[model samples]
Target: MFDVGSGVSANWLRVVIALVCGGILVDIARHGVGPLPFGFAVTLAVACVFIPASPAPLLLICVAAAALTATVDSPFAPGVLVLLPLVHLLHLSCAIAALLPRRARIALAALRGPLRRAAVTQAVVWLMVLVGALVPVGRTPMILELAGLLSIAGIAVVVIVLDRAR
Candidate 1:
């Protein structure tokens, strides 16, 4: 709500990060993660609001996602699908919040580029998810995991190169 007299601050974006963190937790909880670990993640998520520029926010969501993966036996679980976007949302919001001061006024046009990049990245991630879903039920081969990791690194490199070219 960045109205004329009540312009939105970067803090509002941080709040969105926190809310996405909450969504990650709720999805994790639905998979039966215990309160102790959930509570730990809560602390990290809260810290994200105050320190969006740091690695805390990413750590918070990754930990929750890891817990969710461990507790569930299937990669095809709906929770995993649900969390994919939440993690991205938390990451994108925190990144935007980190770039500006708390009192800075944000322009919606400024968000268009980031949001579009996020969408493209998300589409790529979903492609990976589709590939993952096709894997047989059993131990994942070490080579497949390595390939996935390399693919991610490659994507990052390409993104950096493309952005720099513009």
Candidate 2:
């Protein structure tokens, strides 16, 4: 149950987030590596707007978009790189919006810590991706495999540590 006083504000915030995310998704679709890659992103954004409490659909959409970006054989355009962090933010915003109760007085202050943590985590992840992109590496299959494995391991370790800390 929400602290009734803030329900309207909270719902408005949620709608705004959904709209911004949807807009970003549309932009991504417009400039995406391929038309199919971001098609789900826009669709999911609309779904999220209608059903803000269900965060999983938007999460899956984000994952799919990221996967498509990774697998697409496109040039490393600077614009795409800039769009990456915004996409991450949209995902974070959607998650936060979903958690908000429809009839609660959500203290904006209460969100500060979680938002800051999420931002920090996103920044770290983006930095890693940027570094990987900037560093020119041989596209040998063996090296690519090794790098993928290491990345997975690193992500697992980070997840475990974060869980423990929580």
Candidate 3:
């Protein structure tokens, strides 16, 4: 329920975070990660729903990443596109939810800045994914390794420029 002066409830954010967690679990399962790791990741994801401020979300993402690497043949497997946004959403929602009062009401207008930043971040992630997809799958070349480092540097530069511009 929304209260006066706000457009949404904090509980709604919690729901969004939970949905993100579910999305991640689905992605992990689709990758055919073993039952044991998947179960543990599921537990972490569930716990993250309650303690959104905790490191469990990070752990969940890590588990998913490991599973993807182990089961998928390509580092740039198309499924990564799905995982990227899910984890990003999980992080963004959790950060916002953790900063608000338990029963707080929030206006979308108030979230504009953070939401805008998240959009930019996602754009950068998508660009990286595209670049990764273009690379050959066999043994990584030194040039590719250098390109990776440069791309990471480029991303850092973009973040800094954007932050300063704001």
The C-alpha lDDT values of all candidates are: 0.85, 0.65, 0.86
> Which of the two, 2 or 3, has more TM-score?
3
> Which candidate achieves the best lDDT against the true structure?
3
For model 2, residues 1-166, the per-residue Cα lDDT tens digits are 4354543466766666666666566556555445554655656667766676676455745645575467555535644555565566666666666776675556777778978987898789778877877766665588867988999999999999999999
Instruction: Rank the candidate models, highest TM-score first.
Output: 3, 1, 2
lDDT of 1 by residue, 135-166 (tens): 86798899989998999999999999999999
lDDT of 1 at 73: 80
Preferred candidate (lDDT higher): 2 or 3: 3
RMSD in order of candidates = 6.9, 6.8, 5.8
TM value for model 2: 0.59
lDDT of 3: 0.86
TM-score of each: 0.75, 0.59, 0.78
Question: Which numbered prediction scores highest in TM-score against the true structure?
Answer: 3
Error of 1 at 112 (Å): 0.5
Residue 20 in candidate 2 has what lDDT?
Answer: 66
User: Model 2: which residue pairs collide?
Assistant: 2-104, 3-104, 3-105
Clashing pairs in 1: none
Error of 1 at 58 (Å): 2.0
